[model samples]
Target: MGRVEPSLFSSTSDPGIDQANRPDPRAFWVVTFAFVLTVTSFGKYEISRLTPLFFYPVTIGTLYGVSARALLRKAFFALPFVLLVGLFNPLLDRQVLLEIGGYSLSGGWVSFFSITMRSMLAVTSAILLAMTTPFDRLCLGLEKMRVPRVLVTQLQFLHRYMFLLRGEALRMVRAHDLRAQGNKPRIALSTAGSMIGLLLLRALDRATRVHRAMLVRGFDGEVRVLHPLRFSWSRDGGFALGWILYFVLVRLVNLPEWLFGWVVGR
Candidate 1:
């Protein structure tokens, strides 16, 4: 008998890191397509008819080896808010839509589940974008698209601060944990509120000092990129357009449903 190779042994490169390191104009198109697809997921012509086309991004993303775990984690972590907001759907709309596996499903439940699916797909698409494109490149891509310079600079600062803020918050949490009595692990709401206030104060203080330092260092308000966006439209324009066309097609046609029907010979 021939020896079979393990699936893990077939791995080659990490696509997420590779994509982020490579400066490609095509990434903008990919992000645009993903966003368009996500938006279309919410456009339900009928309450019961949920779109499965959104999953196409996941399929493509996996092929390109995006960080599936991080994407899935973020999506799932954000799902409770979607569920909580949509909770009233089942209560408010009681009209029965269809029967599935001996159980009746109402329109509200159908829509609720559909919304959940949409959120998951949308969030996954965004995570894939972040994983595949460096934050600086994304801001540059925005600039290439003729976005305002001030807005792009603000975005860059905001992106930089997201990491700083998270790091600061973690340090604060660690300090809190060190002082806290492990025997009684629960933190009261009032205590949490005070902690939050303190965190904000520290964050503001740090921001002011950083701003003053930047001013002292002869820093202007312009955001400069080491490797600016370089695009050869003749080479990459058609490639972007092709993806855009596919996006439009997907929005117009429910490819999954059509394929299923074709496969079943309906």
Candidate 2:
């Protein structure tokens, strides 16, 4: 079988290095879920309060050696949808909520900013999870958590063969280019349609052959892992508990405000 191409959703290319340091996938998922839930619990206009929640992703990504640039790049794709979600807030909410040196801050803008920040944080956490956790491992973790087998299998196959489909499409494009004699840089509408249909046919054929091969190899619907996942209570449990407590604390206390008050009070 061809190696799975490295992508944002796959773990680091070196399995040995990651396997030792990586937290249990199930624990990581729980921590991520808790963090996201805590983030959304903040009020709609409490943008400043959400500042402390940013530390989780930053710290985790740093420890995992996942660069901030890559995380931000992946998170950038979700910003457009985030913007659309809050696009009408500024217009609908014109009430002045605060003032700074003769300038009034409108409630709409505050809410809009809050929405944007919360969304970016949540999206970054999810992307970070995908970056650190291998897709197969993630599916396995979910299966262990009692997720439906069919759903997990579908996710597994989708992540597994997406690159193969892309490769096939690339080959078709290359063949088209070779026959075009370098005359057409862009494919015509009709040619593009034909290519799409042909790709679909090829993908179907490939799936059939793969299924037969799997059957010959004693294929079963269960996800089989080389090493069974062992969740260490002292390590993985501590990891999850520590993060969950931090999330709760950050949610309950506005650390930025408290720090600022202490500084000024001194």
Count of steric clashes across candidates, in order = 0, 0
TM-score of each: 0.79, 0.88
Model 1 lDDT tens row, 34-121: 5656455555323323354544566656655545565566568788887886788889888988798999988888778777766666
lDDT of each: 0.62, 0.83
lDDT of 2 by residue, 1-266 (tens): 11222534332243534565789989989999998999999999998889999899989988887788877877899999999999999999999999999999899999999999999999999888887877767777898898899999888777656655776798999888988855777788999999999998887788778778888888887656686778999989999999999998898888999999999999
Where does the lowest 10-residue lDDT sum fall in candidate 2?
Answer: 1-10
> Which one wins on TM-score?
2
Off by over 4 Å in 1: 1-16, 19-30, 45-55, 183-186, 232-239
